[model samples]
Target: MPSEWDTHTSVTATGDGLFGAELDPGWVVGGGVNGGYLLGILGRAVAESVPAKPHPLSVSAYYLSASTPGPAQVSTRVLREGGSVATVAAELGQEGVTRITALATYGDLRAMHGDVATTAEEPALPPIEECVPGTMAPEEVRRIAPLMERFDIRFDPACVGWAMGAPSGNGLIQGWFRMADGHDVDPVGLLMVCDALPPVTFDLGLPGWAPTLELTVHVRAVPTPGWLKVSHRTRNVAGGMFEEDCEVWDSAGRLVAQSRQLAMQPRR
Candidate 1:
């Protein structure tokens, strides 16, 4: 329950190449770098280095080894910048060994012809204000509440309630969120938060330990939603690995992003 940042080494910026950060305690089952956020971090690093206004729309990261939260580096290389899309390749390494390789694409929206569809009618979930705030585990509450405070989260107790033994059904969850500080919540920032949540969903029914191994996200737009709704459901779990898929929607129920993850299950 220590600080997420405190548990890890400081992030360093290498002026010559890529930025690097390290995680402390190396790697644990459910405590590794959230995969979704890793993709976002790599994607942001790539898009920010470019002169174009387009942001990364898709990110794919392969886990080469256990990403320890101690000291790691992210190196980015621009692969191609065409008339429409820019492709980037990134590698994260620790102690001279590659840990993750990521490829990302950035593009600007210029009005394309495509069929726009909507998600089916979903029942209105509880409001964040009405949902109970963290109070049970003081250490965990101390750690995550500040982080949540940074983002405007309209949480559904029905989703997180199970962690407190409230009988949260299966691996189904819904919630709304946006950056609370009013910073430009780009796709990468959005992805970071997305990858951080599925572990909770996957651990809903388990009596003990869980950790995410890898996460991949496909983003469609910059996502300027006043409220971003997330619907997460577990697809399958086998051979000590689990997968959870989620769809992200705007306040008006417009689909904006999609994500999937694979994690290792470790029992206490």
Candidate 2:
């Protein structure tokens, strides 16, 4: 049986350079669909359209309009195809209205080699078993958002105190993440995991839907198999707008993906 994420991201060729995917309501966050999940659909379309089975290197997505649960069409155009890298543009639409536009670069990671260096260190986190699991009651899931049920997230207890009326006063969240159905993390799966966490603003006592205006993700390497260690933080909030930075490290401690997004703060 396919996991919810797999089933939702699956696309079928509908025509030349065109594909279609069904948007599941289970992927919704608030009244709008989750941005990352929507991007996954486009990523699949682009990956299938290209001759080489290249992994996504970088993806920049702009939310042109909001979409509800339904069928979505993807139109992909290969901007450039090089010996090592390919650039593609994709648009996701519903009922002939464009909802999201994306530009992505893809390449074979195994063929690339360089002197890898990074000053950033992965945050120390407890074992997944020791962390506090993010679970909601049945009624709460119905009231807030059902998307939480699709992910297996074990959050740092210290960072989730705000849910109990205890604000941490710092906009930071660290956790272990995996699909509820135990699917392996792939490039498309990494995209969904990048945005799966609760907004960092939740710890700042701002609890409402924070719609992403734009999101950009860079895939550093293909993830190693296992649960992913993730962290999200927000350092700035002004004029009802804020930015969230997310880092996803595979079980082998390699940074698989990193994302940054600008979002509107909840209007209280």
Candidate 3:
């Protein structure tokens, strides 16, 4: 059985470099489809355009507006199809309105193996049993953000204070992430995982929804079949805007993905 992430993000060719996709309601957050889920939809179309290079090595997406659950069109243009990597530009639109535009470089992760260097350390976390469930949200928030139900996200104890009305004021979130349905997370799934956690601003005592304005992710390696350790932190916040840095480490202790996004502070 295909995973929900795969099933919902699937795209079908409708000719003219445009693929048909559906925005599943289950992936909605803050009255709009989760940006990561939307990114997956667009990335899938770009992948289909260049099947030889299936993995998204790097992707930068700009959100122009929110998208609702319904039929969506993903149109892609091959910017540069190279031997090792393919660069493509894409747009995800609904009802003739473009909601998100993206550019991506795709490559085969299996074919890349080289030197590894690490200066930054992955956030150390206790066993999943000791962490708090990310799905433990207030009724109102859970009602508007069903995306939480799609994954088994266990937050680091030190990071759960935000949810309990006692934010840590540290602007950091650490957690263990994996599909609740037992499906293996692939390179593309990293898009969703990168943005799966609550915005780090929540722990900084910022309330309400923080919508992403732009997101960029780099896929470093394919994940092993197990849980992924995710950490997101924000070091600056000003002018009602902030930047978030995210890292995902696979079960094999390999760095698989990294992301950074700029978003608005919650309207609250």
Candidate 4:
């Protein structure tokens, strides 16, 4: 079975600097299309436009408006192209209304190297089998957000007490994540996985929709083939807004991707 992401990210070149893709209904969250998925589509256009630099180094997406399931068009404009790196600006639209605008820098990951230092430690997470499935009953999910069914996610038991009516009071969620269809993680897939987890504010007993206003992801390295260990946390929530920081570590213990997003708090 093809992964939902594979199907959705597949785009056809329609014309010069223009591409078309059909957004899958399964990629919806709270009646709006997933921001990361939209970014993946935009990244595809950027990558194809600049074939010399295929890997996304950093992508910054700003959600202009909400989008629904349908055929969307991506228009790309190459901003800069160097021997080692390329930058592109792209937009995603449906029915002639633009929904997302993004600026992305792409390059060959193999040609990049630098002294890497990190004070951040990977969060401890139990084995996938030992963690709690980050999903509701199938029937409930089917009616609410069928998109979630496309991912295999297992959340840290300690941070999931909110689901059991015991709020942890800390905005942190750690988990193991992978495609339900078992697709290997690629650079494009890494973009989607970075935002796959439920909002960190969920553990703080906030529920509903936490719509992302802006999201920026940095692809650190190519991911090894295996489940990704993910950690998402929010340090502050004020004035109906919050910021989430996420880290994606491949099974080989490599930091593959890191992201931060500004999103609205759940409205009750």
Cα error, candidate 2, residue 175 (Å): 0.4
TM-score of each: 0.75, 0.95, 0.98, 0.95
lDDT tens digits by residue: candidate 2, 93-205: 99999999999998877677987687778968887788888774246645557788788899887788877878697999888998888888887778778889988898888
Model 3 accuracy (lDDT, Cα): 0.91
After superposition, candidate 1 runs with Cα above 4 Å error: 1-17, 20-31, 65-72, 110-113, 120-123, 134-152, 180-184, 198-203, 207-209
Residue lDDT tens for model 3, 45-99: 9989999999999999999988999999999999999789999999999999999
Local accuracy of candidate 4 as per-residue lDDT tens digits, 58-135: 999988899999899999999999889999999999989999889999998877899777777877998778899856
Best by lDDT: 3
User: What 10-residue stretch in candidate 3 is worst by lDDT?
Assistant: 133-142
* Model 2 misplaced regions, further than 4 Å: 136-138, 141-143
Top candidate, metric TM-score: 3
Residue by residue across 1-268, what tens digits does model 1's lDDT show? 4333222323456864478665433223343544544455456557655648356577777777656456667788888887777888888777888877877777764433468765555436676577544333357543533334444555577777665666475777666666554444555565665654435543366644355566677776556646677777776767887777777766656666787878676463
Give residue 173's error in model 3 in angstroms: 0.9
Task: Write out the backbone clash pairs for model 2.
Answer: none
